[model samples]
Target: MRPIRRLLVANRGEIAIRVFRTARRMGLETVAVFSEADAAAPHVMAADVAVGVGPAPVRESYLRPERILAAAKASGADAIHPGYGFLSENADFAEAVVAAGLIWVGPPPAAIRAMGLKDAAKALMQAAGVPVTPGYLGESQDAADLAREAGRIGFPVLIKAVAGGGGKGMRLVEEAAAFDAALASCRREAASSFGDDRVILETYVARPRHIEVQVFADSHGDAVHLFERDCSLQRRHQKVIEEAPAPGMDPATRAAVTEAAVRAAKAVAYEGAGTIEFIADASEGLRPDRIWFMEMNTRLQVEHPVTEAVTGLDLVEWQLRIAMGEPLPLAQAEIQLSGHAVEARLYAENPAAGFLPSTGPLNHLRLPKGVRVDSGVAEGGDVSPFYDPMIAKLIGHAETREAAIAAMAEACEGVEVWPVRTNAAFLANCLKAPDFIAGDIDTGFIARRLDALAAPRAPSAVALSAAAEAAVALAQDGDGPWGGGLAGFRVNGAADPAVRLFLDGKAMLGSPNGMSERSVLADADGHIVVFEGGEAIAFTQAAPGGLDESSGDGAIRSPMPGKVTAVAVEAGDVVEKGQLLMVLEAMKMEHSLTAPISGVVEAVLVSEGGQTTEGAVLARIVPT
Candidate 1:
């Protein structure tokens, strides 16, 4: 095989950008293929040349083999890199690339096929004497048949999509009564996600730590494992925090798991980069006997940075070399892990609103200065509702696991973006949590702490003061004193002149000029109001628009962009203080907007599917 001079990246987002950076360093020109929605994405901008593939949908763009091949041909690229996801694991696509005279910078098509189907892969592992999870992989698709099999396997079983990854088609049946329903839902989601409804049932283990070994292979049948990553911190089956040299893993168990991973990769004559995932029970310390094969990721994972940080080697470069027929550069004994690393996926989502996907134009993007940020979008780039809501991957490296965690937490707090709600603060909280700090994490970690995690905390006094200062600055800009001066003079001078001041959905009525002084009088909540030292207070009034005084802070709005999918009620709708008001769908997920107080909806500003920019009004409610 000839060395690659040019490569086409058949993916998008951070992975695409990551591969291109490595390819450039290796003196290889990179070609990026993007959908219509990603034309202005950072990955496209970073590539030496970019080709338009199709529309925003995955089927038409990133998943279309024909379009990818066409782009490769147009760019004169000799190899194609299938970054994880979309068509990355499609054996047919890999075969097609090879058949079209292009080097596939991934495992051979046969290897992909060997590990693509969960049932077949499990059988293969069992045959090789590798640990396999006890489960049912029968050929029956009948719900009753699956249910019966689940009953045989025991009460708690996992219904997993055999043909996909990213936790898209998975369900856990905790009871016999819920087996059929869970199975049907799993099948439907699997069919929708991977076009294959074939699912396998597995005995679900409680408190399992998700561990995976990164393996590299070459054309000469040489392979080695690169330790393991603990990725148990997940939400909705998707990984959130990933770390290297899994804590609490003993050397004996680590050796066994890593060896098994190497065997699994070599069994399929795997070449290039691959990952063998394992599920190990953490009820006891990690042991070789307690671990079982879960699945193999046939391409570079999103959390590859953690692996790279500890090894001080670029996996992508190795992939390119292996694809060019190079032998493994080092044996398993020579590979060394020097330090610990952790990676957090920064997403455009609202943590206080059930972690729903957020979409909007990025008004400000400031990543932490000292850490590594792998991202595909930039400031002013649109976090579209059409794709994944991930904004960036923040990775921190340190000499120890604890230090890495601390560094990651600090980095998250330092990174900031405007107009789109994010889970940065939540991530910081998680890192600081004693359970997480002690590495006691699992798939159920987030779910069990959902209420505490999503609880809205009041803004700090400093933050409130800053916001007040900003409000005052805006007021003093000579923008026009429509309502008069600090003396509380009103333009209409009526008993009550209502001027709209958007304050976290609450209405504040006062002389427009009342905003100028450090202290002013206003009406808040049918009472006398006073504003002092950047705070507002409320009291009772004799009339409907009575004069009052108070001091208080402001409200919190949506940080990012998205579409309002549901409005819980209409005007005059009496809602509880925390009742769900609307659902916003962005980046293909739904987020619930809740009521701030027990109030009547005075106005519904946005409807389902209505496009909303950052700070766009969704509704207004008058407190009861």
Candidate 2:
């Protein structure tokens, strides 16, 4: 059992920062590896030492096992921590780290390999006496044979890639006629996502709830479960909001699930931090008999913070201790769950724009106080197109579930992100939704209420008034016409002061309040752009006579920098309103650009497989 003297985190962003914080508390120096794009990232600055791994692309940097090992060796780091993404679940990387004579702050490579494939992991779980969902794991790749298996599993079956997670390479077939197309699409996605085109079919549980138990084991074969987290709220198969001590879960159900998690761990001789995911049928309330083992995540989870909050434990610290041959810190019975906690991931995306990933500078970012914020980017930091768009996570905890939910809602509402759109308002609305508040959550909850959740939200009258007042105040005594120094001189006593401001090129007129109502001024902090009521409105002195000129033709432009994956139209093609013109892939998400009006496509400026920057016109349309 060798204690680690220095540790190198083979990851980037918030997860790296998270592990570094714990390593520091353990009196271990930390080294960080960064890509070219992240040279000035917050994680790099937080580390005691940093090494450049490679270029901006993850394939050339974070995913390169050789570069990571070399960085660790050059830094003299005795241990390496693979924080959640890139190489966290790569079994070969884990084995290579151990072979290099460095401690790996993770589970055994054998255990990771056992759980790497969902079908194999399910088979292992069933063999270990754990209840598993009914499925077919046969090796037959014939489409006809797979269809027959799907028929046996029944309609609404889930075709999932064996080596996939994060909702990628998964499809649900609700009817027989659509099975072939879904199968083909799923296979294509699987091949692209996991490099494996093989898939397994499972009976899809309607109205299911995702609950995972956090399990930890030490070198001595001792294992304990750190309660459970409810990750039922999701979009695109990725968790959006997670809570600890799942609401509406009874004592019996909790005990059964947690015990099953430990059993699964013991079967593989698991070590360090792992999560056993279970899908619970919630058509009826949560019942132990209805819950089935789905798969095991052989590494720390993104929602680990929620579990840590309720357990009053640092999971990262536990991982370090267990990796160093230490015994489990506490017995299963000694571990206790304290208060309830909820966490919301703040992403740089536009919920209303079909949740398109956004990339730009975080012009103004102010997280609400009185909550825990795990962030890897600072105000003015660029949300680049090279990595995940998650900016930070906000955690709120309280003695009761209701209070915790309320606190999370307040935190989301108070957050201020700008330039790059975010889902802060959407998250706040979800927390307060009638169904959500009553704990009526399931995997289908987001899809069922997506229209309401992603609806275009406008600023409140009060927010508009505040913005108007702030704009007038800034323009007052300033050089612009809206400023008081030049424009405040009223020609008549009967005329009220009016200031012209431009928001997204649209002119706005506003009036200042009387001195008695000027208290709202205190909330102003000189932000040229302010986020209020779920919308960001930028206030700039309008040009005299609104003298903006536009070209004769309507040019459909790309909203963000990305690659044009598809072009649906050519020159001289007639299009209808909202017709798909092109599709742009950015930040790992696809955004479809549509026609704003009926017109004839005069020219297609962008070719298929071409790249474009924000505001780059892809096509010119002449109104019919």
Candidate with maximal TM-score: 2
Which regions of candidate 2 deviate over 4 angstroms?
479-509, 514-528, 539-557, 563-584, 590-611, 617-624
Which whole-number lDDT from 0 to 100 does residue 535 have in model 2? 50
The sequence of per-residue lDDT tens digits that candidate 2 reaches over residues 1-624 is 779899999988899999999999889999999999999999999999999999997889999999999999899999999998789999999999999999999999999999999988988998999999988999897999999999998998999989888777788899989898788767766765567989999999988999999999998978999999999999978899999989899999999999999999999999999999999999999999999999988899988999999888999999998889889888988888899999999999988878888888875677778888999899868898888899999999999989999999988877776667889988988898989989999989989999998775654444445556556545554424321111112222232366565655667765544321211221123434445544555556644454332443588877888888778899989999898898776775556788887899989998977888987888988988
The clash count for each model shown is: 22, 4
Which one is best on lDDT? Answer: 2
- In the order shown, the candidates' Cα RMSDs to the true structure are 9.2, 4.7
The collision pairs in model 2 are 475-483, 476-484, 477-484, 477-485
Compute the lDDT for candidate 1.
Answer: 0.77
Residue-level lDDT tens digits of model 1 in 438-480: 8788878888987776555543333333233333433455333
CA lDDT scores, all candidates in order: 0.77, 0.84
Return the number of clashes found in candidate 1.
Answer: 22
Give the Cα error of residue 36 in candidate 1, in Å: 1.3
